[model samples]
Target: MTRHLIYLSIMAAFTACGDGGKAPVQQDTVIAATGGPDTLNRMVLIPGGSFSMGADDSTGMPDEYPKHTVRVDSFWMDEHEVTNREFAAFVAATGYVTTAEKPISKEELMASLPPGSPEPDSSMLAAGALVFTPPHHRVPLNDVSQWWSFIAGASWRHPEGPGSDIKGREDHPVTQVSYLDAQAYAQWAGKRLPTEAEWEYAARGGLSNQLYPWGSEALTTGVAKANTWNGHFPYDTTTTDGFTATAPVKSYRPNGYQLYDMAGNVWEWVSDLYDVNYYAQVGNGTANPAGPAKGYDPEDPGQQKHVIRGGSYMCSDEYCRGYRVSARMKTTPESGLANLGFRCVRSVANHGQ
Candidate 1:
């Protein structure tokens, strides 16, 4: 999700102490209430402590390797990704329209879409946001049309293009939103999006040198623990994890942090810029270091792209394996997709002040 520009979202269940470090649930697990059940029902208690951020060697991306010590203060995070009901309240409270819902400027269309890809054939460019359902598989990341489509009438209301509705899945993670949309919802709920380092730290669940959130084992072992592609690339999906689209948050097990669906589900947005070599400059000891203050990905330098964590259902061994704690990707601010969603954090000091 790229809002004003930059984005991310994810989930879990069961109440328990967070990764060992400091406090218990009674410490940093307070949740703010919106008008309805839409608000994230659960909150993870992240105890402030120092842990090794990123992994060592070529096992991880250049940006997530050379694991370094990083210390984060205690903070509360939404247990599950923000749902439709919750976002709806934010929209209702403030008539905030997302960039996806905004009309596509001829300039934007020409800039985002492939050249010669005929102009949008609709009443307006805002017919719908790009959804992952269209591609539904592993395709070369460079090929934009392989995964994204300008569906007509698709918005946050209809995650699976315009035909979808939040009927039985109001509790499910909301998609097709920009980072700004998620930020708006977080602000309205009195929270903020988690930073890339914070999100990975929480997802790792205090485990050192881990690959995925659960364990070194993959989601499929005799049982499907998380939602990801099972079959071939860019084609058949066995749905072994259950459902083709975004599954309800927490359908899988929780990590050491008592946080659910952190590995495979939907790719979550994070508050970090994409710096390919950010890890090489890691500082010693545990310190919360934000990525290069104002860096942009070389791939899409014209548009401000922000980092997204926790790979999506589309990730496969043959393609993207970013579901790991240190893995991440970036998207344009105005880009919207079914595979993208978001969660939030809040400053305890801001609770009263």
Candidate 2:
């Protein structure tokens, strides 16, 4: 298979459906105890308001352009990204298996590849996910493959491949989870992923037309603002934020809505099908736009992608400035990287308490 097909096949493996019966543990109780406050208490109510969405500065990518006015209805959102403890509780209560834990099927691999592409070796089709392996020396940022490796047996439980474990990092944001996995947890918790607009609105934290969730302050100024790479990209890291990877939730102050880690820690998965040109198509003063019906990425056109926001510990000014509030990134729904995770939101009308 071609290089693109190889990438697609590996990503497709991450989209496999999970299977297991619900366990005896009460879902509500389990969710309640998984870090933060109990059920409704943990969710902060964001006041409904209007804000300009997308990048308003020169740092924005093409997809973050055509800044438009968006109004979102008030909703309750988690105080922070879902943690390992919370995810573990969800798994314990539901016996759910994440996509990364599932073995790849040849049929699934073939579906993403070209019609007559040769089949990959079975040895390459193991249960695993991508891990960010920083190089000892700086490398070109253009080639992402230089730092990402598909390691077998890598999952949320083992974030850095086989030997790694969550262990004492229960409070840290759960990573290596696919969109489906996140959606599953949201559903079981009687919540749902935030729309791209709702996420940006909540991220903005009542701030209007600002660069970051905390306003237009430079990330490098003052104390460490978020868990981002403090040195050269893909190599040196000063750990100026006191973390080389995902940090424990609430390591820093929260945004205006009292939400933590909205700018960094891990890239948050939003409930929006990614379209490179979606912003151009959006009408001004759109109310609660849910995103396009289909997903498209010119780089990987055949692969359906979803929008991920907030950036991550790996984000740096030299490379990805994803920590910016209006910044946007896309990844295949099935693909889960070490820096990706999610949180949930609940609507006022459907507040299942």
Off by over 4 Å in 2: 1-41, 115-118
lDDT of each prediction vs. the true structure? 0.66, 0.82
Report how far residue 246 has shifted in candidate 2, in Å: 0.5
lDDT of 1 by residue, 233-271 (tens): 556777777877778887878888888778767888787
- The most accurate candidate by lDDT is 2
Error of 2 at 171 (Å): 0.3
- Candidate 1 lands at a TM-score of 0.82
Q: How many residue pairs clash in each candidate?
A: 17, 0
